[model samples]
Target: MVANDPITGQGANGAAKAAAVHLESILAHGDRPFDRDFQQAVADRVREGARPVVQWTSAMLEPAPEHLLGLLVAAAELPSAADRFANGFDAAADFGQWFPDPEGAADHLASLAPRG
Candidate 1:
């Protein structure tokens, strides 16, 4: 779990609560294209405007770690996706244990990459 404040170490709880509120606000507004301003608002609410506060769980690993590895490989291949997942992984590592085995995560993600 990661939070905006590394010193305070609120973990994901604060961010999760804020995200729920922001999601509710978005839903209340109905289906609409989220413009940059709206997107910024959501990001600000979640304390992700400057840096991301991600909360990884067993649920995210779902079914198996392979699923996440595949997703991470795909993300690593794209600039935008890389910014979110791959970069997020680096940021998560700064605060706490990002994964049980960083080497294993890298190997798993590598295995899922498309071979030439």
Candidate 2:
């Protein structure tokens, strides 16, 4: 499969790893992998589908909220519709907002932040 663009110059996998790592950091010692409550909440936030890691990063970056990794994990789990919304939001907002749906977000992110 063709590789996606590098988001933040980190490359696709790197971006994914970064997102995961960041989530781990945000989650901190309370739960190395994130608490079930947090995890479930994240799952709900995500639109509803599988998505690339960087796109997830983009979603988490929204609000530029602190301790973003765990939030990113949740964002990653967003639905296709929600991801798309966020991506479109970001593109229209000059990359300011998350995609409204996950698939759209993933596709949008792939276009903007492809792997090198």
Candidate 3:
């Protein structure tokens, strides 16, 4: 399938994830023919994994939101936070865990903060 441009930085990441999903699905098929069901299942799995990354990249194209901006600021000061943000590009599924909303981002940032 054709994909978006690399401007949002998800082209390579999404391709890698799709490859992994295909590999896993093929392995799991285990002697079964790669039939229509198999193809559909693979498509579903890849779509599930890709949805968050797609959403995150779409949001990024818009003006930055408050919580996203806050997370960026915190990432500058917290190595863990920065790493977490960077890691999302590698495993965009993680974006689903913490990138969608203000509360999740704040909690993630707080957890990355150093103790007194």
Candidate 4:
């Protein structure tokens, strides 16, 4: 069964994505038999889509680094930054652009600073 950590707070989101994958796969298969191969292919597709989300969720489980904490604080005061972070929940892959390391996080925060 396809399942994910509920601690990630993505159970509903993941289920929705899985349902879409299943429906798309079924439609694309046309009259093909629902055999083990087809099921495996669908599972693989789901895993591919979910990989980034899982990575982000796993990261969240770890203790936050100072830079990450800074981002959180900035997010509270910056509406745009907060929105981007909120959007990341739906587009978890976006987290990869800036959420993984100190350098990326710093760069992202800098970008969010108001240009003079």
TM-score of candidate 4 against the unseen true structure: 0.89
Per-prediction TM-score, please?
A: 0.31, 0.20, 0.87, 0.89
**Model 4, span 3-114: residue lDDT tens:** 6677778878988998999999999999979999999999998988787788888887889889889889989999989999999879888888898889999999999999
Candidate 3 residue runs with Cα over 4 Å from true position: none
Tell me the number of clashing residue pairs for each predicted model: 0, 38, 0, 0
Model 3 lDDT per residue over 1-116, tens place: 43555667888878888998899888888998989989998998888888878788877888899999998888898888889889888777787777889998878887887789
TM-score ranking, best first: 4, 3, 1, 2
Q: Considering lDDT, where higher is better, how would the candidates rank from best to worst? A: 4, 3, 1, 2
Sliding window of 10 residues with minimal summed lDDT for model 1: 1-10
Error of 2 at 35 (Å): 3.9
Q: Write the per-residue lDDT of candidate 2 for residues 19-88, one digit (tens) a residue.
A: 5544764666463567787656555433221234446446544665433433345457646434644553
Number of the top-ranking candidate, with lDDT as the measure? 4
Q: Across residues 1-116, which tens digit of lDDT does each residue of candidate 1 receive?
A: 22343432435545556667687869976877778988776766555522333334333434446545655566768564465454453354332232335664565456555689
Off by over 4 Å in 2: 1-18, 25-34, 42-93, 96-116
Q: lDDT for model 2, on a 0 to 1 scale?
A: 0.45
**Weakest 10 consecutive residues, lDDT, candidate 3?**
1-10
What Cα-based lDDT does every candidate model obtain? Answer: 0.51, 0.45, 0.83, 0.88
lDDT of 3: 0.83
